[model samples]
Target: MPVRHRWSAAAFCAFALLALAACGTLNTVSGIFGNQINFTAPQLQRYLNNSFPREFDKLGGLVSATLTNPKLTIPPGDNRLRLDFDVGVRAVGAGEVSRGRFALASSLRYDPATRGLHLQNPEIVSMEVPGSGSLIKGGTRELLNAVLAEYAREEPVYRIDSDLLARLPSGKRIGSTDIENGLVVVHLDR
Candidate 1:
């Protein structure tokens, strides 16, 4: 090949390699999964710690002191519960490549005396983008934020069924009072 032609080929290869690297995939046309911006365990834990306290306080009042108190409320005092959360993208419907989902699983503990609440679980947050390479960081960040908000506001008393309440050892019916009384928790679901 002429010198110019060789240089052109070399440039092309370099560009291709860089492109693959940026996408984090090289095995297929879809490329490696987009780079995942994850919330570190510590980071997520802190967020939950900060948020749950405020949220729980709000939710607890609604549950134990207000008209909405019939719902299961996070106990008062120093209780620590940890949970694992995963956020990822999945194909939800036809003709769509993927939609994001944020999942969380964990335990909650509270102490009425010390007034502390603890959450324990492995938390993960990720995104599911369409197979088409168009993962917009700004949009994803906003979406993640929204999810986080939703997760933070989840209340213990919002979804109780009367029949279920009757079966409870407490013998109290508390599910139907109101759906709008709890804190809002948002996060990316895996």
Candidate 2:
């Protein structure tokens, strides 16, 4: 079962964007944004922490993988968000197991219709099982990549059900979003 997330980057960004228009409506966003809002990496990290220790079964339930302790980073001057995860894998009934780290980086994209933020071009940066002293086997690597891709496509950092994106005043819409000084900064199209 997936736990509900109360702190939303979409909410944070959208609220800041909206608050920019109605300045007095939200006091918390007073200095957090203007033409662009900065979503700090720390905030995103905290939000993702609640959804962790996820388990996945692949290969006809022969393999079990658990992902935990997601460390999210917004590299300064980069648009892509880097995510690092500690992964544990076991081949049930075979007594084969391995533990490792998986890292990936992706840029954020928004869908106006769904009002969702999705990962775009999420690529695996590295997969290392330090104790094993070798990279994951080819089959396991493929499985991990497949799992990562599927998971990346299915989950978004934030999503809103409302048609809020369509209602931005004066045709304004979310534009280029990039990381600067370790913060995810969103610029609006004016």
Winner by TM-score: 2
Q: Which stretches of candidate 2 lie over 4 Å from their true place?
A: 1-35, 112-116, 131-136, 159-171
Per-model lDDT: 0.32, 0.69
Give lDDT: candidate 1, residue 189: 19
For 23-102, candidate 2 gives per-residue lDDT tens digits of 64332221235466556666567667866888888988888778899998877677689999998888878654778888
lDDT of 2 at 145: 81
- On residues 1-190, what C-alpha lDDT tens digit does candidate 1 reach at each position? 8999999999999999998797763221111112211112333344344333221112322211011111122223312222332333222232222333333333432222322223333133333444435554444345445444444344331122244223433322111111111211211112
Clashing pairs in 2: none
Worst 10 residues of 2 by lDDT: 24-33
RMSD of 1: 22.9
TM-scores of the candidates are 0.24, 0.67
For candidate 1, the lDDT comes to 0.32
